[model samples]
Target chain A: MSQLLRQHIEKITPLTDSEFTYILSHFTPKKYKKHQFLVQEDAPVPNDFFVTKGLLKASYTNLNDGKEHILQFAWEDWWITDYQAYFNETASSLTIDCIEDVEVLCLSLHNREKICAELHKIEHFFRRKSNAGYVALQRRILSLLNSSAEERYHQLLVTYPQLFQRVPKTLIAAYLGVSRETLSRFSK
Target chain B: MSQLLRQHIEKITPLTDSEFTYILSHFTPKKYKKHQFLVQEDAPVPNDFFVTKGLLKASYTNLNDGKEHILQFAWEDWWITDYQAYFNETASSLTIDCIEDVEVLCLSLHNREKICAELHKIEHFFRRKSNAGYVALQRRILSLLNSSAEERYHQLLVTYPQLFQRVPKTLIAAYLGVSRETLSRFSK
Candidate 1:
């Protein structure tokens, strides 16, 4: 499990054994069964989780309709959080729940800032990751605005085909902001 | 203009005068007229622009209809670019144009990376900025998924009322992904 974390960090920059050891010390490992909530709406978000295994989703619920809007899915190697809540130290506006049995290394904001102040490379790694996430979100916005629902459905399939095999179609439809019938027609 | 840049960076981390001078040297100041293109689709994107004056917008156009979808609007103290193109050092997938006569400080990828590698605080500043950008984009995703066009219009007006005063209603309609007629009704 530590090796998975090391490899993930190493993808951004190679770290020496001692360096990785120190950074790893700041994180706490935790596991959850399928259908567990990592974060709940209105609760304080204390940590950001880096998934080592299993799948999870982050979503916001509309108070008026009580409809769930899927914001993102985090599988192996992905980071998931109510980032605004985590960074600002406020109540979460989103919920993150496990879709499969999950393992993650959780880092507190204090530890994250300490390590960033300590290691230049770690800061670089995080900055790059954040930039990549920003670009992906921008792409998603473009997809939502410019593409038809059918076009977006195909795009999502092409981008994360493995997701279809793991996630229920109903949830996938929610992620696409489409009716289940509409998604089924696209899938066909 | 440099003071605006310093103040922006200092919002995240303080910098000594010498350090701020060194960082400022990496950027080139330039100005553009309203209606000028800062970036054209398919052109190589070379720099990220930091707005010190006036306004600009970045957008992608749908191929079939040639309809523009505004990705972002940048005014004084804001940053704007084809980030995917700038970061990847590739041709732009979007166009950026001046919404008003604009003045900006442009930083190339090479210079950006060089400064980030050289100055730890600069790296910290960029990471913090990126994280904030990521969270903002996430909010937009939730809004896009959950809000009706009327709700979105009101939210936009409330959040950035200055945008309405500075930009044309037709462009605001484009930004909201609403028809001009629909936007007219909302404005009424």
Candidate 2:
């Protein structure tokens, strides 16, 4: 698990073994069974989870309609959290739960800041990650605004083909903001 | 203009005058007239603009329908770019243009990386900014997924009331993914 984190970080910045070990000490490894909640609405988000294994989703549920809207998904080498809540130290506006039995390394905001302040390279790695994440979200927003449901389906299929196999069709529909029947038409 | 940049950076991380001057040295100040393009689709994107005055929008045009989708708007103290193109050194997929006669401090990717590499605080500032941007985009995505056109209108109106006065209703409609008629109805 530590090796996984080291490799992930090293993709952006190289880390000596001792440095990797030092950085790894700030994270606490946690595991959850399928369907277990990692974050629940209105609860404090204490940490951001870096996934080593399994799948999870962060979603917002409409209070008036009781409909779930999928915001993001995380699997191997991805990070997941109620980022607004985590960064702002507020109650969560979304819920995160395991789609499969999961293993993640959890880093609290305090520890994250501490490590960032201590290691310039770690700070660089995080900044690069955040910049990449921002670009990705921008692309998603553009897709949502510009693409038809069918086009969105095809785009997602081509971009993250693994998602089609791992995520249920219904959830894909939720993410794409299309009805299941509509998504069926697209997939067909 | 330099003060604006310094204040923006200082909001996240304090800097000495010499340090601020050193940081400002990496940026080139540029101005654009209303409707002039800072970035055009299929052109290389080289700089990320920090808006010191006026407003600009980043948007995508649908090739088939000849319709536009507004991705983001930047005004005083905000940063705007074709981030995907800028970060990856690719041709732009979107167009960024001045909404008003604009003044911006342009920081090329090379300079951005140079500063981040040389100054840990600048990297920290950028990381913080990116994290906040990620959270904002996440919120926008959630709203797009869950809210009605009317609800979204009210959310935008309340959140950025200045936009209502400054931006044309047609562009606001574009941003909201609604018809101008629908936006009018919401306002009424």
Candidate 3:
């Protein structure tokens, strides 16, 4: 199990076996049943979870309309969290719920700090991942600003075809910033 | 001048004078006049600029409409780049333009890699910055999904009040995902 994670980390930086084991010691393996809430809105986010199996959705409820807008979906190898609350140690305005039965490696904020102090290269690994995340967010913002609903849907299909299949269309529609009816029409 | 950057780096990680000097040596200073382009759309992005003085905007032009959307604004102490292209070494789809006369410390991808290799703590500094950026991006995504235009504008005002004075209203409106007219109407 640690070998899988070590391989992932090795893709970015070469980590010695001992270093990989040292980093792995900080993570706690956790499992969630389908539809279970991993993190709740308005609650403190203390950890970030890396999915080993199954799917998860990060979403926020619209107060005005009482509708949930999916912000992101994570499958195997993806990290899921309420990043704002996690990093700031503040109450989260978002919720992460299991879309399918899930097994995840959870790392606490405290443990993360320890890893940074103990293994320096781990920080570089996380930094590269964060840089990639920043780019992804920038792309999403541009898409929302300029792309049509159909175009956005098409982009999602092209970029994350697996996610389209794993998640329900309604959730995918919300993530794409479109109505379910619109996604249905566009799909046809 | 370097003292200010040293202070910024110290905020995240403690670095000795020699280490700071070594890191500074990797940066090349550059200047840009107002309205000048730092990077152009569909061009290779080789460097990331750290603002020392003045303001800049990074934007993407919609190919279909020829309209541009501002992705972000950089003032003193802020970093600006088409990160996607910078990291992947691909042609950038975005352009970075100076909104006000600016001075920046430029670091090319090659030198950045060299710094990471030589100074391990520098990697930590960048990782922490990237983590903060990721957190901010997550918040921006939530703002777009859950907040009204007025709410987003208000949040932006609270977070970056100085930006209103530094950047034009049209770009600010675009950053908040609202039309310039809508922002003007809301302000009144």
Candidate 4:
């Protein structure tokens, strides 16, 4: 557990055993089987999970047409949650479903508040992470506005090459705001 | 100046005069005339500006078609910057222009680093701000994927009604991934 957690933190900042333990104390470990739903739309989100292994996709379906859009994908070392619900304490508008059997380090809003109140440095670490997430989403919005379907597909390949293999092509196509047919043609 | 700075801090967390003064000391007052560029595409961005008066728009243009997309609009009490550039210390891909003659409080990377190092509470405040920003961007991306032109326009109005009056119709339409004509029709 420490090894997996350390690998994730090292991507952001180096942590000593004491620091890692301090952070680890706030999280609880859990495992889920493939096709498990971590969160469901319209339900309250109680916790945010950090992926230790396997894959998960956060998605939402349009009420009018019932078409689903993949909002995000998480592999090892990534965090997954219905962020809108997590932050605002509202009913979730998205669902997080496991694509592969998974292990996660889960932290609830209660634990998170305690950590922020007690360990301020950890708060700083999360702040930096959130800033990076914002930057990535901003870039995605810009790409949607300016890039062609082909360009976005190429970008996904460049940015998250691992995602192509880990996620189904149909989900990847949805993520790129294109049809699977378009993605198939682009891949060729 | 203190009142404005205090208001900014209180938006996230309450701070005493000494704490507010300590934070304010790190910000440098800046002025830009109408149409002045605060940041340009492919240029280094070193600071985030807090608007004290007037307004600004952060935007990018497509090289192929010369079409522009407005990423965000900043009014008094709001923060603006090429966040991708500021946080990453990379050349900016977006440019920020003074949409109206403006006065701003600028915080450089150096000062921000010092604040994070010396004032732990400031770091927590920043973390909360970043979290909120990340949530907003995530919602925006989801809207782009699932919402229609009119739905998006309506959502935008519900989210940022002040922006409707302050920004041009074309810029707002572009941000919503629509045309000015379509936005006009939707608004009616």
The model with the greatest DockQ is 1
C-alpha RMSD of each candidate structure in angstroms: 0.7, 0.8, 1.4, 1.4
On residues A1-188, what C-alpha lDDT tens digit does candidate 1 reach at each position? 88998999899999999999999999999999999999999999999999999999999889998888999999998999999999999999999999999999999999999999999999999999999999999999999999999999999899999999999998999999988999999988
The collision pairs in model 1 are none
Point out where model 4 deviates above 4 Å.
Answer: none
Give the per-residue lDDT digits (tens) of candidate 2, residues B87-118: 99999999999989999999999999999999
- Model 1: CA > 4 A from native: none
Give the higher-DockQ candidate: 1 or 4.
1
TM-scores for all candidates: the values are: 0.99, 0.99, 0.96, 0.96
Q: Please, what are the lDDT tens digits per residue for candidate 4 over residues A1-188?
A: 65887776677667778878888888989999999999998999999999988999999988888888999999888899998899889999998998899999999988887777676667767888888899999999999888998999999999899898888899998888788999999999
Model 3: how far is B152 from its true place, Å? 1.7
Query: Candidate 1's residue-wise lDDT over B58-177, tens digit each?
Result: 999998998999999999999999999999888999999998999999999999999999999999999999999999999998999999888999999999999999999878888999
Candidate 3: pairs in clash: none
Per-residue error (Å), model 2, residue A64: 1.3
Clashes of each: 0, 0, 0, 0
DockQ of structure 4? 0.84
What is candidate 3's lDDT per residue for B1-188, written digit by digit as tens? 57778888999889988898889999989999998999998899999998999999988887777777888888888899999999999999889998889999999999987897677788888888988988888778778877889988888889888887777888888787678899998789
By lDDT, the best candidate is 1
Clashing pairs in 2: none
Task: Between candidates 2 and 3, name the one with more favorable TM-score.
Answer: 2
